[model samples]
Target: MDRQKYTIALLGGTGAEGSGIALRLARAGHRVIIGSRDADKAARACSELAGLAPGAALSHDANPEAAAAAQIVIMTVPHAGQQKTVQEVREQLAGKILVDATVPLVPPKVARVQLPEGGSAVAAVQRLLGDAVRVVSAFQNVSAHHLRDLAHVPDCDVLVCGDDPEARETVVGLAADMGLRAWHAGAIANSAATEALTSLLIAMNMRYKVPGGTGIRITGLEETAEARRT
Candidate 1:
């Protein structure tokens, strides 16, 4: 699996989700490129990322450069940075699959689900990028803490929603590579439901004693010849 044809580019890779994914891919023997707004930050993070997977082709580059170098781009930045980030790297993202993991978490009252005026972050990205980029929404339900520890495969499913079937499939494959179970959650608008579920899960976590805990189990499937052998 490490011999995957292309590298995973993580924009805003210094952030929790982005960095966690970078490590996850590295552990899985896949090439990963961490993109940062600051060149110096990328340089520092790249060194640590390389340490995670010895001799792994892991490196850091500026957002645009990383986008250009990778086949798939996962945007792990916050909702606040989505538009500007896309605009800045729009040229590099052309014809690329851009996974949007943004959640509209209005900090002070994030306990409640808040859909933005743009409907959903996935829709917002589609609107902002037009046809230049293929945006897929995913990874909104998992905690960054769990993703970083490659030893623990969280019992969560990644809800991948996007207009482009190829892009969605690419993300699903990438999710599997990262030890995640990804589901095609329909068109980008469906992201509104999945993104909202994040808060519901968080509220449940708060009520319970489970810290940074949330998971989904796909029932009705037993270990068989056709299923993925764990």
Candidate 2:
């Protein structure tokens, strides 16, 4: 499959996880707009990423403008701000693939599984955006430390979930572009499992004393991995 380059907007892209994601996307030859609540902050992030991904098409904007201008919008906001951010950019999200990477970790107790009322954070995004938006859940378990390191191909897998099969495939391809294995993990509701796994990974990271943060690899998929390499 030929890879398609997209203009991707990472909302709340000023943060560590968001910036790391933007860097990978920009390096993959996709145009990346780092979106933040403050335009200056987003611009600063873009400048920093430019050095990391030299000659990569990278820019910045306030979240709403970024969301409106991009082919795909990725939500990387903190769980506390997820709802407000989505509501602010709701109109711009229509007819676009909205990838929700929001993990509902309630701070200090982040190691404990604390799923929201709907069970899945991305599902809440889907409900908020309605049918006009193709909301896909991904990147919940990818470590920022791994993504920021250009030489490091994350020893992990991305489980993409969405109500739309095509949208899920698009995200799976995007993950491939980041040099990671990804799979269609079924409907949007299935995202609850992946989202909840973030907390478990956190617990394991602490218990095992792994500095780069622990990640997941789906076992017994050698054939799938081989097919991708062919």
Model 1 stretches astray by more than 4 angstroms: 1-3, 221-230
The parts of candidate 2 lying over 4 Å away from their true place are 225-230
Tell me model 2's lDDT, rounded to 2 decimals.
Answer: 0.91
Clashing pairs in 1: none
User: Could you list the CA RMSD of all candidates, in the order they appear?
Assistant: 2.3, 1.3
Residue 144 in model 2: lDDT: 93
After superposition on all CA atoms, how large is the RMSD of candidate 1? 2.3
Instruction: Report the lDDT tens digits of candidate 1 across residue range 33-109.
Output: 99988988887777877776678778888888888998888888887788888888899988888898888888877
**Clashes within 3 Å, all models in order:** 0, 0
Against the unseen true structure, what C-alpha lDDT does each candidate score? 0.81, 0.91
